[model samples]
Target: MATEIATLGGGCFWCTEAVFQQLNGVLEVESGYTGGQVANPSYEQICEGTTGHAEVARLTFDPAVVSYREILEVFFTIHDPTTLNRQGNDVGTQYRSVIYYHSPEQQETAKHVISEMANVWDAPIVTELSPAETFYKAENYHQNYFRQNPLQGYCAFVVAPKVSKFRKTFSDKLKQF
Candidate 1:
C-alpha cells in the first residue's frame, strides 16, 4: 500500500484531527503548526496569533484504500471552507482554512476538488492551497486531543459534533469504530 502525507488546517487541529482519525486508510494524524513565519512555534505562540501560523494536522494515509481526492471530499464537508481565516467561532489566521499540498499531484487534486465544491457551496470557498512546509508536531498534550479528552469542554461542545457529523455524512469512508 502506498502511503502519502496531507497537511491541512481547518480551524482547530483537534477538530480536524478527530475526523481523519476515524477514516479507514488514514494511518496517522499529527496535530501541528504550519504555514507560518515562526520557526518551531509552540501552541501558546500560535494561539497568540503573532507567529502567523495555522493550526494544522499532518496526516499519513494509505492511498490504496482512500485516495487523496476522497480525503479532500471529507475535508470540505467537515468544515466551512467559505469562512476565510476562521471556522465557526474560531477566528484569526491560526484558524484559517488551508491545505498544504505535499506535491503537484496533491495540489491539482486540491484545486479540482475545490472547483467541484464551488457548485455545491453558495459562497466562495476560501480554502487556501499551498505547498507543504516544515511540520513541527505540537506538544504531546495537543496530540490525540479529541480522543484523549472527549469530555473536555471544547472537545465535547465542538470537536465531538464534527466527528459525529463526519461519521454520519461519510459512513462509507469511515473505519470500523
Candidate 2:
C-alpha cells in the first residue's frame, strides 16, 4: 500500500510518538531528530539544545485511511502550538512545535490547517511549517518509549496525559486492539 510521511515535533518525541501510534491509519511512528545541522545527532546533543534539531516523531501512514489534513488536526489538538520553543515543562528548541511537510500538497494542507487552528487557539499558533529535512532515527531506547516504560516518571506524568487527551479527543480514529 502507498503511504505518506508526516514529521512533527509537538514536544518530547515520547509524547508525540505515543499519541500518533494510537491513530488507526498511522502505520508507524518513529521518534527522531531533524531540522538540525548535526548528522546523526545523539539524544544528549539534542537535549543540550545546540544541534538545532527538534525531537520529532516521523509517522508513516496510509493517506487513503486518513487524510493529511486529519493528521494535522490531530497534531494541533495533542500539543500546545502557541508556545515558542517550549511545551509544558519541557523548554527548549528541541521541544518546539513544528511540522515538516514532505510534498507541495502536504505543505499547502499544513498551511491551511495552521490557519484554521489559529482561530481555535487563544494565542497565535507558533508551529513552524517547513520543508522536511534529513531525519535521523533516535536511539533504540527512544522508540516506543511510553509503551515500553509506561510507569517511568516522564512517561507517566507528561506523555500519558497527552496520549489520554488524544484518545479522548479522537476516539473514533483510534486503531483497533
Candidate with top lDDT is 2
Lowest lDDT 10-mer window, candidate 1?
A: 168-177
Q: Cα deviation of 170 in candidate 2 (Å)?
A: 0.6
lDDT of 1: 0.93
lDDT of 2 by residue, 64-171 (tens): 999999999999999999999999999999999999999999999999999998899999999999999999999999999999999999999898988999999999
Candidate 1 wrong stretches, greater than 4 Å: none
Cα lDDT over the full model 2: 0.95
Compared with the true structure, what per-residue lDDT tens digits does model 1 show for residues 1-177? 679999999999999999999999999999999988989998889989999899999999999989999999999999999998888889899999999999999999999999999999999998999999889999999999998999999999999999999999999988886
Candidate 2 regions exceeding 4 Å error are: none
User: Candidate 1 at 7: error in angstroms?
Assistant: 0.5
**Cα displacement (Å) at residue 90, model 2:** 0.4
